[model samples]
Target: MSGVVLNDVIKKYGETQVIHGIDLQIENGEFCVFVGPSGCGKSTLLRMVAGLEETTDGAIRIGQRDVTRMDPAERGVAMVFQTYALYPHMTVEENMGFGLKMNGHAKREIQTKVAEASRILQLDDYLKRKPAALSGGQRQRVSIGRAIVRGPEVFLFDEPLSNLDAELRVEMRVEIARLHKDIGATMIYVTHDQVEAMTLADKIVVLRAGRIEQVGAPMDLYRDPDNQFVAGFIGSPSMNFVRGTVTDGGQVDVPGIGTVPAAGLDAGREVVVGMRPEHITIDPAGDTHRVDLSESLGGVSYVHLLGGNDKIVVEERGDYRSKEGDTVAIRPDPAYLYFFDAASGQRLR
Candidate 1:
């Protein structure tokens, strides 16, 4: 296994700069995922590390070697792209062994590597088939197997599962996770899917507009986000942000929900209160609002309430009897509530 280090990396296209100075250290055998929206430089960063794109400044080190200016083949890294870049004419076995063949490895060694990779990826049964004969997931596995046969010190994936169907994506995700465990190689993956980043990564680097927003374990970012952006981006259904002004008695007065005690906040300061949908519950005896909609999802139901002028979603356990236009009292758990500075969007204690 090999660790990758990027020191103050920068990329520029003539006068237009895309990637700001980025410094990141990916540890050996760790699964680090880069997640962000489209045109956020996630793919550009991955390509830079793979030697496909040149870095305008700074250095890139894979293991102990400085490979900033090295050719793609010279670097001990294998990349799996979004499109299954398999040769249509070649059989699965041939495609998997092609890298080793080009590098002039012994025929027996190439065969052994291909067989091992195929077994690991569960592609053993389709070795003689061409790319067209394989399913989308199977073909993606072949693409991964091709990388594995090269015995790269590090593996880089650029949205390798985006082409597959939803079910196939899940299946491939499990396969990729298992493959990481079995191979024990350092892998860096780039994707826009939060679920993928949360499930597959040992560490996640969240980026925004050419700069990193936050980097930490999935739960760390989810539970204690540094700012509103990280808080809103990391959670499913997203965290709800209610705009309110801090009151004189150390409380935030929502337009219709009345004053919520702001224990640690200074009085008379404007702030945005954030709470996850799942953290809010329906309280029958408390202040109530008319429910606009209720979506039942087996184990839990989400109740959307019209809180005066604001809309609040409450997650209730089991079946909820609330219906449209029915008033239901709802309250947010204090412990899960977060505060952010209204102007800067930074988290406040």
Candidate 2:
């Protein structure tokens, strides 16, 4: 297993800079995920570490070796792409062993490696089957098995599960997590899916438009996001941002909702109060509003309340009978309120 270190790494396409200077240290055997929206430079940064793209400046070190200028083949890293990239005509065994064969490994060694990888991936039964003969999930496993056979120090994945169905993606995600635990190799995965990042990563690096937004454990980023963007991006339903101005007495006045005490915050500043839907409850003795929509999602129901121009989504336990135009009183949990600077979107005390 090997750790990856990036020191002031930057990537440029001629004159346009895509990846701003980024410094990150991924621990040995750590499953680090890079996640963000499209055009966020997550994939660009991963390719740079894989040596598939040249870094315009700074250094990349895998283990003790500086591989910034090294060829992709020379870097002790294996990359699994989103498209599965398997050879159409080659059998599973041949495809898995192709890299070792091209590198002039002994025939016996290639066979042994292929057999071991197939067993690990549970692809032994399909060893002689071609890509066309396998299902999407099976083909994906072959792609991963090919990487495993290489015995790479670091594995790079660029949205490898994006092509799979929703159900298959979940299954493969569990398999990948188990594979990482069994192999204990440092893995860097790039994906736009927040669920994948939250579920699979030991550490998540959140990026935004070529810059690092935040890097932390999944819950850390979710509970204490540095800004509105990170908070909104990390959560499922996204945190609700209610515009309010801080009064002289540490009270914030929302447009529709009446003034509420700004706990742990100074007064006389414009702020945005953030409340998660799960943190808000339908209070029996609270301010009343008309429910615009209620979505029952098994264990919990998301109740969308309409308060004049302002809207609040409250997540309630069990089956909620509240429907459109029904009156309900929704109150946010005080302890869960997040305050952000209205102007800069920075968190406020």
Candidate 3:
């Protein structure tokens, strides 16, 4: 029942407002991720929840307690920062039990809790090793182990995998997912990486400039975004937007490409046709498009195309490959097309 709730939460430093009033409910045992570009206040909001930052103008409730003004130690929440933040002089076991030691925990009790955390993180073998002796991934596990030893009601991760290498990031992502599955604890994670958000989060909160843009399940946001920003931000290769004008009989006229059938819109209205890269294919009989470059990555390739003043990337799978400077016809699937108002950048039904 230890769910986190933020009601009209706002953060500001004097007159410079950063996090606007954000109201959100993170259910118990839910893996909620606050994801957005840098300076979007994702970390700030997480800090506010952790009691590391003050909630300037709203209520923050963790479980049944109103902890808007509570001290960090009294919040009953554990935080794992991006850095390992481990003590170089102390072994893994010592570092993991340091917080409990300072809190006047019994030596036997501390050892028992540390042992359980070590088993969970698979750090049992590295208990005797110092931070400097362990690898980056192992060090991070030590940090997480420290938090686990606290036995807090909630776990907060602030870009915990950003410090790892690409392969280690993947490995740790799997490890964290497994950890959540095992404990089923209420967790809140913050990261700018969309891949991390998509893979790790049960609920994704997309933010922009201190404001919430969208909040939903990962694939839900990817398949049906509320606006153009969410549509463009959630996907790996962003959605392609081509400016066009609505023509006769509710048909949208794409520049450099011919008219496409679109209903429920006024004629002669300016709009942007949104198409995901995966939905578009190279058709020989389709409109001739210029291929700028191709990024071949083993199983798949992303073909970059120059369409008028914009750049569009198409994901090609299997044996299909497009060379640079090749003229190909780009055909977009009619069923998957998305329409947005050109002026407001809002999705059009």
Go through the candidates in order and give each one's C-alpha lDDT: 0.90, 0.90, 0.92
The 10 consecutive residues of candidate 2 with the worst lDDT sum are 280-289
Better of 1 and 3 by TM-score: 3
lDDT of 2 by residue, 1-349 (tens): 7999999999999999999999999999999999999999999999999988999999999999999999998899999999988989899999999999999999999999889888878899999999999999999999999999899999999999999999999999998998998889999999999999999999999999999999999999999999988988998777888988888777888775667779656677778899998887776444568878888877877888878566788777864456777776766777888889888998886
Per-residue CA lDDT of model 3 for 239-304, tens digit only, reads 999988887788998876678889988999999899999998786444467888999988889999
CA shift of 61, model 1, Å: 0.9
**Pairs of residues clashing in candidate 3:** none
Whole-model lDDT, model 1: 0.90
lDDT, residue 322, model 3: 85
Q: Provide the TM-score for each candidate, comma-separated.
A: 0.95, 0.95, 0.98
> Residue by residue across 155-256, what tens digits does model 1's lDDT show?
999999999999999999999999999999999999999999999999999998899889999999999998999998897777988888887788898765
Candidate 1 residues lying further than 4 Å off, grouped into runs, are 284-288
